[model samples]
Target: MGKDTDIDLMLRFGQGDETAFRSLYMTYRKKIINYCYRFFFDLGTAEELSQEVFMRVYKAGSRYRPEAEFSTWLFKIATHLCLNELRKKRYKNWFVSLDSEEGSVANQLADPSPEILAVMEGRERKKKITSAIRALPGKQRAAVLLREYHGFSYKEIAFQLGQSESSVKALIFRGRDHLKQTLCGEFGEGL
Candidate 1:
């Protein structure tokens, strides 16, 4: 069978086609899951949030408008949901853990060079950087994640976060400055 286009699938799904909705879910699940994973640093929570994101989409399918690209709308929804979760009292202290198993994997993937290992303590440096990112305030962290990690334009981030583009740029600048300070303190000026 031929693959249905995104707009076509979305239109069909809006008309109550379950199969089309499932197809849409299958298409974006990994991206949503990874996005959540990066913020929460917990696999189980990320998986749960991914399911919730799709559930929200399924419920709101009838209201889905095509004014912008489907991805823009989808990311707007995901960003709001993540912000809500971050605001919950239970997660007020949800900082990323440097000693977590996930951190170890990230460290391993970041600096795989044997020569680099010989020149520097790669794993320890990676952990410090990760911890510094986690130490940032939520807005700064979100701005950094969306722009640096997700490759969002400042305008796109402003749309997602309901801020002005200038504000988004400021947040990103502050976040990067904080990261730089933290990394430099831990790994010296060269890092």
Candidate 2:
């Protein structure tokens, strides 16, 4: 048998086809999960966020118009949810622990007895850059992630973010400037 097309699956699901919803869910689950992970830096939270994102998709399916590409629309939904999550965390003053998200800085620094101090300093500098990106305003962070991490065009990001193209560009530029200043501070003199 052949696979159903995206439009067909969406149409069927809109008409209350549970199987179509299941099919769509299975197809986009991983992408949504990874997208959320980019924001939350935790697999368990990302998984939960992905499920919620899919639930929103199912609820909004009937009202969805094909005016935009399904992939773009799906990402818009995911980005909005992740941005909202960040806002909530900000209001609560909660810090996202990126400790387990990557290799330990400790482990890298531990065996630094032989290697030049500059290489280990570079690793620390990278961490500062990552943290500075995280410290950006939610929209700015989203702008950076969409453009740099996901390779989205300015037009596409502005559309997804519901902002003017100029505004999106400004956000990315300001975000990058902030990261640069932050790294400069961390590495001293000529970063």
Candidate 3:
């Protein structure tokens, strides 16, 4: 069979095509997992949450609306799910331990080759940037993640978050300011 388009694959999956569902799963799995990882800072939890997100998609297939872009819809779901998780964590007084075994700072700092080490250091710096992002209020974090990590335009993020584009911009601005304050000590004046 010829390769199916995303819309066609989604339609087939909605009609109970197992192979089509598998194809969709294979296509977006890594992206979703990475997105979740960036939010939670835990590879295993991200993997589990990614699977859960897909499960939700599978279950909602019959009601899936094509009015919005598929990716926008997918990210809306992911954003809500991650926000809910964060809220629960907050209510439970739980925090992502800095000492978690999954890709901690020490591991990131141990690169051998100088060039690779520099690249790794850059990644670590970005991780710190993201860590400051996580420390923002929920809406700010969501806005920053969607814009910086997913490259979503303000209008798209506003649509996904059901906010005005100006609101999205404000959230992003506040997020950036918070990150700048948190990172200024390390990055110096140019941050």
Candidate 4:
């Protein structure tokens, strides 16, 4: 457990040990869900995507290899699925509705008071950041998330992304630059 036995568990599962697969799934399920959630900012979609990742894991267990850390390989699968889903969404022009006919949660809950206004402003800033990240090209977004959010090393990210280390660096740099410009433009020089 100290040094990541996920590879061992995966190997055991590959040898037809069902409990190893269950243990592996139990260990990484939440991490996978949250990874997907951070990637797309949708709980439902994140859950769905994580399930698909595990499904792929289950199906491919027989052919699993230990070329990298299991987490890195697992995330590579998730990343590819995420990029493909983003491409599909882009083509479909999908949009998630923030409000229903009744009204948005913010509108219904707000009393137009001082404290509520501060909370609303914070939410707005977060929304802006999410929007900026969502606007990034799929690979750039994946690179940034793997490095910044998941604490992945440059080499690990490059391996997970199937890109050279230099390419991963450039993607992260460009992603950060775009976020800085978008957020700073909204927040002014103080940002």
Best candidate, TM-score? 4
* Candidate order by decreasing lDDT: 4, 3, 1, 2
Off by over 4 Å in 4: 89-111, 188-191
Candidate 1 to truth, TM: 0.76
What is residue 34's positional error in candidate 1, in angstroms? 1.4
In model 1, the runs with Cα more than 4 Å from the true position are 1-5, 94-123
Model 3 regions lying over 4 Å from their true place? 1-4, 90-127
TM-score of each: 0.76, 0.70, 0.78, 0.85
Minimal lDDT window, size 10, model 2: 94-103
Any runs in candidate 2 off by more than 4 Å, and if so which? 1-5, 16-20, 89-129, 184-191
For 1-191, candidate 1 gives per-residue lDDT tens digits of: 23337767888899989898888788888888877776666689888888888888888788877765566567777878877887887777756555656445546786567665543556666656768876777778778888777787888788888899999999999999998887786677975
- Scored by CA lDDT, what does every candidate get? 0.76, 0.74, 0.76, 0.83
Q: What digit string (tens of lDDT, one per residue) describes model 3 on residues 58-79?
A: 9988676675666777787788
Report the C-alpha lDDT of model 4 over 66-108, residue by residue, as the tens digit: 8988889889999998888887845245444432322355577
The model with the greater lDDT, 2 or 3, is: 3
Scanning candidate 3 in windows of ten residues, the lowest lDDT window is 91-100
